[model samples]
Target: MSTPDRTANAPPLDQPAFARLPRDTGGPVFAEPWQAQAFAMAVRLSAAGWFTWQEWAQALGEQLRLAAARGEPDDGSHYYEHWLAALEQLVLAKGLSNREMLRERKEQWAEAYRLTPHGQPVELSAAMHGDHAHARVLGN
Candidate 1:
């Protein structure tokens, strides 16, 4: 999808609200103002069974500080990657999902890959081969 165009006279990145905006890959300038706000909303909604606008503001503020320290500038960044990271952080913070669940999912996927005939696992069940099946014992 085409991204919306930002005005040339757009406000500065460090202005009143933009100064504390979260970094997002999508939006006006890769990491434009509202992208971070959107992510913060999702995280807040998923946590504490609440969605206070003030809490969202605080979360974005903290996220902006952390991203800036990590060298995330006013320019936009990879939106989906940042979104995933935010979700992970919120999940961990709220204890919604455990590390073991993530690890288990990773291992299960790895095993599925290993069991596939080629290096890549086939998504269709009919794609599995029985080449390794033992031949019937002589005259059973």
Candidate 2:
């Protein structure tokens, strides 16, 4: 007997990759099914190699479990947060990224925030750094 091809067994990315939850029940701003769908689409696209999907999923799942354990009611966390948590988890699991990368990006945003004369923040993106840079600075 030979081992089967795992790649061939993999489900198509177009199919549902996650379970659905009641839209109206989980947190504000995510009270719509479309919002959840948007998050899912981002994850799926990242996983398909548009970026690092594994990293994103890892982060998102970790955040969700942490929130749940911290007494955050299931109804309280926004659906996007859960998606983000999973992303974080996947990142960490795959070593595609790390907390230091996140921390550094955050520090950059903070520095940008303080230096902006407009008392506003800056916006950071992968294009700005020429890499898959995470974190965003708003306002500026």
Candidate 3:
């Protein structure tokens, strides 16, 4: 899917909470496709009125702070991990999904990953049922 315009509704690039985001001259950079997907999910969710930008900044800041407190490496590799964590928390807090459901879906993805052959796309089993509306948004 096309990314929303950076010059449009995106938060300011200079925000303190975003200081550690991996970026280059053009803008934010992602080491993997999933990273950009996560970033876009956050931007879309916020714009959709799920949360305000300040709340997003605070949630992301808290995730980064917690990661630092736990002594995770400061390298940019984990930035999107923190972003994903923050997104999960925000979605849960907003009552979009419950903890049990989220846990199960995560486990499903883990299982699917383990069951897939190398370099092949991972797919959840046919028996799996998920909230496709939200799952699609989060790239689950």
lDDT of all the models against the reference?
0.53, 0.58, 0.78
Q: Which numbered prediction scores highest in lDDT against the true structure?
A: 3
- TM-scores for the candidates: 0.40, 0.45, 0.63
lDDT-wise, the better of 1 and 3 is 3
lDDT tens readout by residue for model 3, 63-121: 98787778675566688999999999999999999998988777777766765788987
Candidate 2, TM-score vs. the true structure? Answer: 0.45
Candidate 3 deviant stretches above 4 angstroms: 1-28, 114-121, 127-140
Clash list (residue pairs), candidate 1: 25-77, 25-79, 30-76, 31-76
By TM-score, who's the top model here?
A: 3
lDDT of 1 by residue, 28-123 (tens): 542555566656557557565744555445555566656766866544345445555555555566676788766655554444455567755444
Model 2 CA deviation exceeding 4 Å by range:
1-66, 119-140
Which residue pairs does candidate 3 place in steric collision?
none
TM-score of 1: 0.40
Task: Return the number of clashes found in candidate 1.
Answer: 4
Which rank order by TM-score, best down to worst?
A: 3, 2, 1
Global local distance difference test of model 1: 0.53
